[model samples]
Target: MKITGLMVYYYFVCHKKLWYHLKNLNLENESENVGIGKLLDETTYSKENKHISIDNVINIDFIKRWEILHDIKKSKSIEEAGIWQMKYYIYYLEKKGILIKKGMIDYPLLKQRKEVELSDDDRKIIEQVLVEIEEIGKKEKAPDNINSKICKKCAFYEFCYC
Candidate 1:
């Protein structure tokens, strides 16, 4: 399976969700939180060019010129995941001969934004993550759910819990 920016985000958020996603057991369409996020993504950045898909692998929310990338979020509950997702975007573009200065994660609901920059160490970690994700994708069953508060808002909540 191709490693996507969303999959990279899921890797940090929940391994089970990542596995479910890897298996094509998609539940995002049945999610209310996801619906809200989609609404927010559409309405919040009306003026900006959004949903920029890179080689059909990653879909960046937008770009500020060609040097900076922007990703919008509904909240910062899994902020680290969002940060890593941004770093991965920077790394992906760099591998394609595009030099990105940095990335910004926009939490429109919280009225906050966090800036992310790719480091040599981050690139190494992302590389390892890609390998690990491949391993997860090969599993016969979905991994155990995290059973955290975050799960309540996740797209796979019902599938995992109910």
Candidate 2:
């Protein structure tokens, strides 16, 4: 199965979420948080280059100056996940023979911007993450939920909890 950027984000947020997503159990559309995020993505760069897709697997928010990849986020609440998601995109393009070494995450709501780079060390980590993601996808059942604080705000909260 092909892993999308969302999978990478889910991997950092919760392993169970990652597994469920790999299993094709999607709940993002049902959540207001996701809806707001989509709104931000659509509105923030409405007049700019946006929503460029590659091989129908990776959806980049925008490419600036024909090089830098820009990913828009609603918030920095889970910044790490967004950063890795950007790295994953850069890695994906590099594997496609496109040498993209940098990316940026724009948190319009928070008025913050973070630049991301894919290094040799990050390549190693991403390789390991890909392996873990493959294992998660192979599981027949989703992993048990851990009941973390983030669960309350998760789109799958009702599916996994209430």
Candidate 3:
């Protein structure tokens, strides 16, 4: 299966969310926070040189120098989801044998850019994660909802909690 960076990201955030999304069940409208954040990300990265492509492999936010993939984010914290998202892009590019030197997570809110280098080990780990994600997606039920402080602000709170 062709996995996009977003899928990897969602899986990292909540496997149930990824399952819901892949199964054509989404609750994006239940939370305007997610929509607003998406808008801001698009607006912030909407540059003339930015190349947005939604292919079977992944939805590329921007291709720097036609080599590096840039994933622009607007989150306060650099979560595992964000890191895996960048790695997913790097994996796709590497699997395609493209000259993708690395990937970057551009946090406009923090004015910080984290560069991710894909080493051989990193690639292997990403592949393993992908396999696990795919297996999780095939399950019949969603994962248990473990309440956390982060869930208070989560876009999927209403669906998973209330």
Candidate 4:
């Protein structure tokens, strides 16, 4: 299976989300929050020069001559999940023997940029995380829904909590 950057993002955010997304069971299309994020993603990236390879493996949100992969986040707070997602992009590109020197996570809301680089050890860890995500998806039972402060802001809050 081709692991796209979005899958990696979902995996980092919520395992169940990745599972549902991979299985084409997502039901959050009606969420305005989700739509807003998608809109921001599209607007931030160049429409003509953008190149997407291997489904979601290489999503060049905005690429300049320097070959930098930029991911724009609309969230006010930076989270580990975003870092993991960026790392996964690096890992996937490196696994394919692509030349991805580094990536930048642009938090538009915070007006900050986080640089992401993958070391040899980081690749190993990302591979392990992917395996774990796949295993969780294959489980006979889904994990129990646990509400948290983050859940209040989740696009699937209504589907999972309501």
Considering every candidate listed, which one attains the maximal lDDT? 1
What's model 4's overall lDDT?
0.71
Name the regions of candidate 1 deviating beyond 4 angstroms. none
How accurate locally is residue 37 in candidate 1, as Cα lDDT from 0 to 100? 88
Residue-wise C-alpha lDDT for candidate 4, range 54-155, written one tens digit per residue = 554557566555456777788844367777777887676666677777888887656688888878888888888878877776776655565566667676
lDDT for 52 in candidate 4 is 51
Q: Provide the lDDT at 118 for model 3.
A: 77
Cα error of candidate 3 at position 42, Å: 3.1
The count of backbone overlaps in candidate 3 is 0
Tens digit per residue, CA lDDT, model 1, 64-148 = 9898999999888889999999999999899999999999999988888899999999999999999999999999988998889
Count of backbone collisions in candidate 1 = 0
C-alpha positional error of residue 121 in candidate 4 after TM-score superposition, expressed in Å: 2.3
**Model 2 over residues 55-160: C-alpha lDDT tens digits?**
8778999998757999998888788999999999999999989987589999888888999999999999999999999998888888889888889999888878
Which whole-number lDDT from 0 to 100 does residue 60 have in model 4? 58
- Cα lDDT tens digits for candidate 3, 33-117: 7787778766886663664664666777788786788877777453678888877787777667776787887888888888877
The TM-scores, one per candidate, come to: 0.96, 0.94, 0.87, 0.83
Q: Rate the local accuracy (lDDT) of all candidates.
A: 0.92, 0.88, 0.76, 0.71
Pairs in steric clash, model 3: none
How far is each candidate from the true structure, as Cα RMSD in Å?
1.0, 1.2, 1.9, 2.5
Residue 145's lDDT in candidate 3? 84
